[model samples]
Target: MEISKGQSPHTQPNMRTAKVYTALESLLCVNCKQQQIIQNCESFLKLDAQLRNKRARELKVCLNCLRGGHFLSNCNSRSTYKKCHRKHHTLIHLEVNKANETIPIPQQIVNENTITNTSNQTNSTTNLSSSTLNAQTLLSTAMVKVNDTEHNSHQIRVLLDSAFQSNFVSEGLFVPQISSALPTHTFNRNAIEIPPNIKLADPRFNESRPIDVLLGAGIFWSLLSVGQVKVNQLILQRSKLGWLISGELVNQRFISDQTRASFFSLNELDHKLERFWQVDEFTSNDHILTNDEEYCEEYFRKTTTRDEAGKFIVKIPFKASVHNKLGNSYDVALARLKNLERRFETNPVLQENYIKFMQEYQRLNHMSNIENNNDNAFYLPHHAIIRESSETTKLRVVFDGSCKLETGLSINEAQFTGPTLQNDIFSIIARFRLHQYVFTADVEKMYRMVWVHPEHRRYQRILWRETTNDEICTYELNTVTYGTTSAPYLAIRCLIQIALDNQDYYPLESQVIKEDVEYSQEYSSLPSLDMSQ
Candidate 1:
């Protein structure tokens, strides 16, 4: 028999082959139990290459068999029989198409019992169709429920759950309740008041007590309250005997109305205060001697004698202590004087009457004193003479030990040269005067008492040596020595302290200066004299 146009050889029931084909011809759709003719079957193929081989081996099965539509024992025979019948029916349907005659399957039965049964089956199919419907029925049901009034009550609950999960609530939302439970009070702002007496205590009050008294009270309070300035200890123990009120109180505030009036009235006090810390007029000069003619003539006549050569040599007591400490013979001091004359030849000031007196004194007594060994007649150079005695020793040691004179001349000579120099010298002299009266102090072993720092000690070393065990030992400074950068500064520091300690009794009269050293007392005033004496 010839096969139809759309049929493949695999579709023929008698043509069985072991090779499977995925084409439409090889398929037998078990759903309708029909041969998969080329016109009736759909192609079964994998879209991806990876699944192609697996899909080729996959056996196509019917969905009805998977759902247990037929008895398992009779499935094979039934499937075969259905396939044959379908093919025959399709062929008949096609042949009838040539005659254009329409034929329908028996969808209705004529028997009454059969009609009832068909109705039941129809109802059953309707139910089955309802079960298989898409999401439209579920959506309609949900819409009806949402329209109910009872469902609106859940909206707030849903919103709260969403907010909680999102964590949008503030942390302090509940804190006020706890704090409110603990305390309950209202502040009466109008009831609080400041007192009139306390208002007077304010520092800004214009009509308050005199500034000096106020400052004095403040200082007293400060001393008492802070326990730093012990007035009782100061009085009893005498620890602060010479201590003066200085700093702000001494400078800006008045100790009394009288003090204030006095301070403001006079130019002298104003100048002194302004220049209080300035060096004295006397000590500012490098020289202690003056240019007064009569003074110089008298001093020269008293201190000098002429030699055969008419050379004037100074005559003044040259103490053994001065000679010993200076480590120089009398001849050296004499030579130095000659050199000084040569060096100062052009300085008219040095040739003033006072200096001339000194020159005459030297010339008159020089030869006689040297020959006769008259200790009182022979005068030593200022640099050569060392002050002795306990009082002078201590003062000299403290001041001269640290202070270096200028290289060219004695402190006295330098002082007479200029006003500024005079001021500095006077300042130092004032300090010394203050020290004498206030402290009632004496010099220690002077030069021997001065102690130089080890680092600076080398600067004071002398070339001379002493023989010890027949071996020479170089001489080094046994005490603080002059002629170093730090010396004058150290001396001024000591002098200031001494002046402070003695301020109460013999307050500084003038400032002092050595070379460049200067000292001034900011709080200095005229001390009351003991007129009864």
Candidate 2:
């Protein structure tokens, strides 16, 4: 209508409700008095709700004009705005220049029953002269006919929904489901089988028929090759659900299908995933904690019990392999002793780190000498290697338990290879991403934090030199030694044990660590290791 109200004077009014003004043509007739006809009609306006409520009993207010004692037609506000068309408001003439516009059904095709029933019940009817419906046609149904080469042509009622990417037919249409995972992502997972067909569908005018299949973007991509093909007078045009084929083709390429994603298959290699990769730079922080006497004493107290003689006996088990390499390992240890002496002479910093390392080793009681050259214990051979990294200036010493004898049997060969104890890299990255802020710290000398049983310490001996010219000395390692096959197992198991032991102090972090460590073991085929302290 020619609505002149406030800032938006030229805006159209809704015609269905009596609360708003009707169009100029609906209000005026050439032979009739327009004022007298509209004065009796009700009016609607965007009035101050409080003002209307205060004057509700006394004032005969015009809701369209927001004035007292008269209706919209009798008010002066309706006469100020101009009309572009004689039959309708100026706002109705604005056109949308889009590729897909809703096309209305012909008069003959629209069910007579719908019009008669609507008019009789609600006094509502469609504009017969108008050739289009609202763009959002909720009842978007279609009749799809399968033109198959191998099977007989069949028809199915389909709903063209663009929300999903894949086409879906009833599970009854396909054979038994395969053992492999289905390609479709919907909750109703079913097999994807191809029917050799050139599908054609007539957008159904009625919403009565139930949809048997859903034609998604997957089906739309196949129709791109057909290009503007027609069925009778219907030509393809884009719609929200997909293309609508009802009018003549305006151009050879009606609309581009760039919105749909192109699908592809993964190669055989891509399907085989071995381990997760991490890109974060991890640095060792082992250099700062040179004094480990306190750490060693705590582990000793937690892991040992006093015997009748008041001696600390380690309660942990020491499992060794059947193969023995004591002889060859001794030879390697002697050679490494010479190399260590030479390095001590050349590098003063190494001498300091070595002195501190030995101090902590002695305080921890990591090894003890055989009494009076006793032959009862196994004299395990050990060799030392220097580790230098960007994280630390001083080189750290690591013992080698893999050195073999003439029989080719070493400590690593004789010990249990232990279960996989580390968490997968992907899970760590995922958890890191979950929190807003993150910090990571490495455990210093993690392997040396755990102790070995006094009996098992006999198999973890090492050779050392107090001075460059001093006689070589032998000491059995009373702690888990690095470079051994079972070392990782023993260390990781101990770490988990310590976490469990202190879980009550930091419940949340401990629970997370425990769950992460146990998750793989529960799902994997590998035998679960006993990690109780």
RMSD of each: 47.2, 27.7
Taking the tens digit of each residue's C-alpha lDDT, what string does model 2 give over 397-441? 566666555676666666555444455544555555565544444
Model 1: lDDT equals 0.27
CA lDDT scores, all candidates in order: 0.27, 0.47
TM-score of 2: 0.36
What's the TM-score of every candidate structure?
0.17, 0.36
Error of 1 at 524 (Å): 12
Which one is best on lDDT? 2
lDDT per residue for candidate 1 within 1-533, as digits (tens), equals 23333446557755544544454443544334357422232332212222322232243322123212333343443332253343122111221222244322222221212211243322211111101111110000000011111111111000011112222211222221211110012222132232222211112211111111111222222222211222221211111111111111111121112111111124456577657655422322334444442343344346444347532233222222332232222343344344444434554443353244333333543111112232312122322222445342221211122222223222222111111221344544465455323322223322222344333233233221111123322233433334332333333434443444556665432121122133222322223444212
Tell me the spans in candidate 1 whose CA falls farther than 4 Å from its real position.
1-450, 466-470, 483-489, 498-533
**Per-candidate total of colliding backbone pairs:** 62, 9
lDDT of 2 at 205: 34
- Mark the regions of model 2 whose C-alpha exceeds 4 Å error after superposition: 1-328, 343-349, 369-393, 501-506, 515-533
